[model samples]
Target chain A: MRLGAALRSELSKLFRQRGTYAGFVVVLALVGLLTWGSHYHQDRFKVANELGPDFVVAGKSITALFIARAAMDVAMVILMPVLVAIVVGGLVAGERQSGTLRTLLTRPVRRSTVLLSKLVAGCIYAVAVTLFLGLSSLALGYLVFGWGDLVLFRGGLAILGPQAGLLRLAEGYGLAAAAMCAVGVLALMLSVLFDNPLTAAGLTIAVLLVSGMIEFMPYFEQIRPYLFTTNLPMYRACLKASVDTASISISALYLLGYVSAMVLVALWVFSRRDVTC
Target chain B: MSASSVIETEGLTKHFGHIRAVDGLDLSVHAGAIFVHAGAIFGFLGPNGAGKSTTIRMLTGLLRPTGGEARVLGRPIRDRLRVGRSIGALVDEPAFYPYLTARQNLRLLASLSGGARAEEIQEALKLVGLDQDADRKLHTFSHGMRQRLGIAQALVPRPRLLILDEPASGLDPEGLAEVRDLLRRLSEEGMTIFLSSHLLGEVEQLCTDVGVISHGKLIAQGAVGGLLAGGGPAVRLRVDDARKALSVLADLPNVMAAATGDGSIEVGGERDSAQLNELLVRAGVRVYELRPAHRTLESFYLETMRAGKSNDRPDAEKAENDNDGSG
Candidate 1:
């Protein structure tokens, strides 16, 4: 019961802050930009030239599902991860910098309970931002471009009906949300080590950029599969007409492992460190 | 720990690497009526870096002591689940969600400590004289208002004990008096208040018991009246010819006299006030007023600190002597 109160308090604090809604605003702008950009280039729109020179551009192909999927793909590159980083990075470090952590820690709440509530709140924010991007893109695309079948050219050509494609887009969004949550947890752990929210967020994004860069390094190929960035893009596998359940499950497990390890690290440091701030 | 002691610490030590912020110190604060009409207001007095805040932090479970253990209200300091609920604290500065209103901040803090009813929150706000301004955002508050809100938050939980660090830091004279009266009222209601502050006069008037700390060590701890009365008998005389009076008192055997800033001569050491008055009068110095001087907490604090510093010098000399002999 005490933990429940603390969680409610934590969530209230998180949602009440002005910076918490920044990610949603960024998502709205990105979705709007992507929707308009896709429409402007609809005449020349093609998944890939490698799919075929004969596969001509069709305006009807720019459907709501396709646009939503496109928005996720574009956002996952840097936007969504940074947004999650900013949200979760401030969960603990921001309070510490502002000297509010000392007041909260001195209460009846346990350190572990505080960390857990923040972790859950960060993940909740991650999911919220991701879903907001996905839904906004879909809703705006339907109003502007209309709905139709989705033609995907990832790993070869695959045409999916609107219902099947919407389901696939939903699955992709869910998986993307999970990946962003893993990123949030990673930022949460860094937040425990840093007293500045900007420092933690910047470090998380730097780590993400470095990890993304490492995937292309020939010398790092052996360790590439184990890197978190490799697993973050695993949502793409769900976007395929023939979803690889086993591969998705393995990637989900890796994300879970990373989240659990990060949370444990956060809890250990927060519980043992002195709250002089 | 005594049966009536509300706070007890055994060798409570906290070392920040090379600096010992709080050394091995034992202290006990009893809860019964010792100085006040009821309850007990224990003031932990110290200089800037005297470990007063460090000790209070440990008791509040904000910082973990390196080498000692403490219990508050019968529960170990580490058992925050029980102890935290029973203690209300405002450590260092009053910090809250700047975007949150004062009432909101109190309510949020209240939820953390087993929750508080609406009336309890209102009563706490009213007690701190913040009832009308409780709806204002903390960002708009001045330092004094923030300090009052800090006290209000501590009282919202209605704990058995209050641990405040410099509670009157940013208050004006009126606010200070209000806080003093409020604390006295709380103590009379049988609440144990353990506050750390350097306001000696306030401590002298408000606290029933005081513990003096210096360089992370407890130099003195006892009743305020006892500590003040324990000093040597002294007398203060307002005389027309201050220099002549100083010269006259200097010839006396045991009297140590000096002209105070307020144009009065303070004579320390064992001496009768009437004898000194007559001696000054005989020396052609018109004595305006003469009375037995009462030692202020400020003097007691300074004397205690000086003695503590002098005591450290010998220990350092002995350690140096032992080192030289070994070499």
Candidate 2:
């Protein structure tokens, strides 16, 4: 019951802040831009150029699924992770800097309970923002461009029917949301360690950027598979004509392990830490 | 720990690196009665950096003590959540989300403490005279308003004990009186309040009991009236031939004498005014008038701090006045 009340309180605070809506608005605007840009310049599309003039990429072929997939590629790789970091970074450090953590800790609620509630709330926000981006891009794309069979260039060229395409899109979104949740939890851990929200959020982004660099660089090839960033784009596995369940499962387990480890470290530090602020 | 005490500490200490913010010190506050004060309003007094806030933080479970132990409401301080159930604390300064309204802030805080009814929040607002501004955002609140809201939050959960730090720091005289009245009413209803403040006058008026700490050690603790009475009697006198009188009174043992601004002599330490008069007269100094002097809590506090310092170091400076002894 205490945990429930704390969760409710946490969620209420998260939603009431104007910054929370700013993330969604930004996501929607980006999706809208991407869809409009794709509509006006279909011939310039990379998929069209790769497939040559034999397969026209204009009109009925530029579907909602394509827009969502394009948006996810950009959003999950960069935009969503940064947004998630900013939101989760403020969870503990912002309160500490503002001197509100002292107020919150003095209450009858357990420190572990408070940390758990915040983690759950951050995860909820991650899922909500991820789904909003996916659905909003799909809707805006459909409004501008008509639906059609989904074409794929990932792995090998294999066309999918509308039903199978939508299923793949949903699966991709779910995996991306799970990855973003891992980022949020990682930010939460940084928030516990730092007193300044900006420092925590900036450090989380730096970690993301450096990890992304390591994942793509040839110098880090030996350790590429071990990096969490290497697995962050595992959602692309769902987009393939023949999904690699084994690889996706490994990535999912790695993310789950990362989140669990972050949660435990956060809870331990928060419980024993002094609230001098 | 006594059964009637609501707070008890044995050698409670907190060391921040090399600085001992709170040294090994023992403290106690009774539940409702049988303490120094008739009511259970424990006023923790100390000079700046004297560890009053550190002690209050430990009692409220905001800081961990380096050594020793403390218990609030019969539970050890380590059981913070349990101890928090019966105590409402406002540590350091009152802080809330600037975008949140007064009512919303209260509701958020209330939900953390097992929840509070809307009526309870309203009543707390009314008590703090913020009922009309309950819907207003906290960003618009002044410091005095924030202090009042801090007190109101402590009352929202209707806890058995209220621990406040500097509860009257920024209040005007009018606000001070209103808060004084509110605290008096709360005490009348049997709430044990432990507060730390630099407002000696307000503490004198509102608190039944006070503990004075200096250099991280508690030097004095007792009823307001009893502690003040312990200063002993001081006598003011008007004497003819002030030079001779000073010379004559110097011969008297254990008597401290100083001249007042109005050309009269004030003497303390020795209770009897008549003996001094006779001794001065026989020594060729005429004694004109003699009367007892009044000592205030401020004077007592300064004198105790002086004495505490002197005792802490043998080479310390002498007291400003001869009568200024640690009571």
Which candidate has the highest TM-score of all? 1
What TM-score goes with each of the models?
0.90, 0.88
Number of clashes recorded per candidate: 0, 1
Tens-digit lDDT track for model 2 on A1-277?
4899999989988999999899999999999889989988886765767676687555356788889888998888789999999999999999999998898888988889999999999999999999999999989988887676777777877677888888888999999999999999999999999999999999999998999888788998998887878887778898776789899999888878877888899999998888887
The complex in candidate 1 yields a DockQ of: 0.68
lDDT by residue for model 1 (B1-327), tens:
554467888788987655677778787534222222227899889877778888988988888999976878767898987888888999999999998999999999889888899999999999999999989999999999999989989887788999999999978999999999999999999998989887888998999889888777788888888877875866778888889898898788755566655777777766888888787788788998888777777766765765677676454344434534654
10 residues in a row with least lDDT, candidate 1 chain B: B29-38
Candidate 2 lDDT over B190-282, as tens digits, reads: 898888988888998988888888766788887888887874876777877887786776667766565554687666565577788788888
Model 2 scores a C-alpha lDDT of 0.84
Q: Could you give the DockQ of candidate 2? A: 0.64
- Residue pair clashes in candidate 2: B234-B293
Q: Which stretches of candidate 1 lie over 4 Å from their true place?
A: A47-50, A56-59, B29-38, B237-291, B313-327
Q: Roughly what TM-score does model 2 have, to 2 decimal places?
A: 0.88
